[model samples]
Target: MLKERLYYIDSYCKTFTTRVVKESLDNMGNWNVVLENTAFYPTGGGQPHDMGLLNGIQVTNVEEIDGEIYHTVAERLDPTGEVEGVIDWGRRFDHMQQHAGQHILTAAFVELFGFPTVSFHLGKELCSIDIDVEDVSAEQLEAAESLANEIVLRNLPIETKWVTETELDQYSLRKNVAVTDEIRLVIIPEYDYNGCGGTHPSSTGQVSAIKILSTEKQKRKVRVYFACGGRVLQQLQRKNYFLAEASQQLSAPEDSVNTAITKLLETNRTLEKALDEAREALLSFEAKDLLLNKERGIVKAVFKGRTVKELQKLARLLVAEADDVIVLLVAETEDRLQFVAARGAAVEMSMKQVSASALLAINGKGGGNDAFVQGGGERTMAGEELMNKMLVSFNLDI
Candidate 1:
């Protein structure tokens, strides 16, 4: 037997009494009860299921399977007598406003530019409709939004009616109906006429307002994001809060916040460039001092808290100053050790030999050509010990 859909009869019906025809455990082991008549709307047509209490047991989900509407509840109930079901009005009305807003906005797009809405989704806080176009301009969005709100302000009646396939020709439809039997059409008078199975408000004014938040390209179409009714107010409140916080932190008025932020970023970039130049000058002075203490045309030094890049820069500066100099530098940090080996253009020894011996002593990995090599690994051995191992491999007298 087909259950009477009380929601279709009266979308405003929040509470109803219905007899439970059957009760069983669903595939996921949840209790599902089928009622002889129900006001709860099932999840379908991009709209979510209605949720509320069914005889005090919370109805978690409602779905239609094989033409029967099953209400999934927290606990099992007797399949013998009637049960009282209540709909969450807040959620129901929010959906109504958004769904209706979509219809109005969709019609506005078609009426203004012949853009057809191919799909729609009613999300928790926002709603979207994908149009059959590659792109939509900001001006088009503004025009559509303006026209949609005008319809809402006019408060046109929203009507729904069941029609047969043969009777569908009496009025022009925005799109073809998907179902042949029990064809339901939601009409906004001479403006929008389309087949839909989701719940909506009785009139356009109930939507309160419609705002197109943004749009993005999806494949060959454009998806428009929007919010309606109470959601619009919530979005405005959230954005205002963020702007207020930014203004206070920047010590600027709301209207001048953008200018202040841009100026701050520019100042930061200038300071960073100056710091880099100063650090490079200091490294060059230190490299010259180290060259003065060289022994046997080889310079060796150990330092703390220096990066491998800095060590490489210092070694390069040392070799550039003397034609016969070879530099070996090690930097130690809390958890690791880094070293650089570089030789002047006139030096005969390959720095690769130094890196190979140093890497083996610390169980590290590094690579370079005949003149320069650098590497770092876990601080398994003391930096001085590793440097002594490399010197031995070099067969240097020092």
Candidate 2:
């Protein structure tokens, strides 16, 4: 016979003595031990497996295969004697809290609205449930969350019962039970009754609290992220830490941070607009200076520590402002070279030909028409050298 899962008998049981029924090395060279009976819950029902030790050997994983629970151990142990199994209570209880909180929250959504949970996942740090709804509103989420907390405050009894498939119709199930022969129902009397095999605390108060962190649209469903029990406190601590840092950096109290941020953003926008006007004025002056230095309808210049975007903008301004002119500009960054070539509407030379010829100097790639072309590549050659190469293609002196 397979080992009786003691978790079903007592969800709070942390330690038990069970005989090692069989032991074998898995393909990964880890020992997989079967026991006569066990308290360690296997990985199922969207909850992770219990982890701790078996006979002082670390139990890293637990899985159910063919009705037999196999405990994956870190080291090989004696295949024949009685072994002491001890579960990590903190991990197990946290899972129980989260799983139970999921039940309460899911029930609340179904009760307040017609939304049903299409799927659920109990993660290590957080839990999420996908609702069979296109979207969820803040008001709906708050209402469901409030009701869940209310149930927790009431400390309602969380009852569990085993019944055959024929006996399931007596209670109103939240959804259809997955198993027919041996159905385990987790019930909060007059509140929720659902088929579940996962372990839970004896009462709703153990869940402590449920805080919905965020919601996102997934396909035709709404996936809600939430934290429960100790996770709620953990989330609060993390957010408070961030809030404190923000308050200090903004030089404002928590209450005034929002207003301060809004004002700061408005001021930043004004400063940006002024800076844009200044940049345009500077570019206009630079274009005039370059036109004076223009040689045979071609203007070439190289800049250090500038972005390709700035170089392109300057080249565009130069060609647009002057008729019968061509502009070749290069900006040297820390690790690469960027260049722009452009011709005015009156100029007949192809910017693409100039760019393609100059790109060979730096092993670069670019594409454009006769009006404008841009590219960037390795800093093998100085920006000035690259610009000179483009000038050579146009048969103009640099």
Candidate 3:
């Protein structure tokens, strides 16, 4: 026998008693029970399923398969007995408000600008409608929102009718009905009429309000994000909380918070630029001192806690300051060693030869061209031992 859908007859039906048709265990080891008649709306049409209780057992999920509504419960139910099912009224009502609000907003766009809604999605915290348009302007969104809320305030009756395919021509539908056998049309007087299988409230006034939060371009179309009824208030509360926290942290009033943040960012940029210039000057002075103390055309130095980038900069500065100098610099960190080798333009020997020989002693890997080479590996040997190895590659007595 076909399971009677009590939700279609009355969306407000929270509780109903029905005979248990079958009982089975799903793949996930959850118990699924089917009832002869169900008030729970199964997951369909971009709307989630209704969750509640069936015979005092928690109904975790509700889905329809092959014309059968299976209610997944926390516990098993007797296969041949009657069971009382209760719908979670709060979740059901929230879905009703959001679904109805979408119809009104979609109609408003079509009525004013001839833009049709291509698709709709009802999320947990927000709802979205994709329109068949390249872009949606702020003015257009405001106008649509205003018209939708106006319809809600008018409290127009929301009517649903079941009709045959031939009778569909009697009414002006916003879009073509997908099913021909049992077409269900949701109508708001002459304003909007569309075939939908989702649940909705009895009147538009129950939606409370409709707010368009934002919009973004999706390919060639535009997606409009919005919230209705309690969701609108919830979004507002969350935004207000963030604003309050920002105001306190910035030590500025809510109205002046943006100005304060802009000023702080500008000040930070200026400070960063000055600090970079000062560091560069210090490195230049250190390079000149190293050149003055060079021995036999080679400048060698070991640094603690210096980064590879800093070593590269210092080596470049030292070689640029002198015409006949070869610079070797090593930095020792907690567990690894880093080294850089650079030679002045007048030097004929390639730094590649030096790095190749020194890298072997440290069991490290590095790469650079002939004139300048850099690499680091394990700190198996001390910094001085690595430097001595580089000198041996040059056949220099150190």
Better of 1 and 2 by lDDT: 1
Name model 1 segments beyond 4 Å from true: 1-3, 269-398
Clashing pairs in 1: none
Q: Model 3 over residues 229-278: C-alpha lDDT tens digits?
A: 99999999999999999999999999999999999999999999999999
User: lDDT tens digits, residues 62-168, model 1?
Assistant: 99999999999999987777799999999999988999999999999999999999999999888999999998899999999999999999999999988889999
Local distance difference test, per candidate? 0.91, 0.90, 0.91
Residue pairs with backbone atoms closer than 3 Å in model 3 (clashes): 364-377, 366-375
Write down the TM-score of every candidate: 0.74, 0.87, 0.77
Task: Give the candidates in order of TM-score, highest first.
Answer: 2, 3, 1
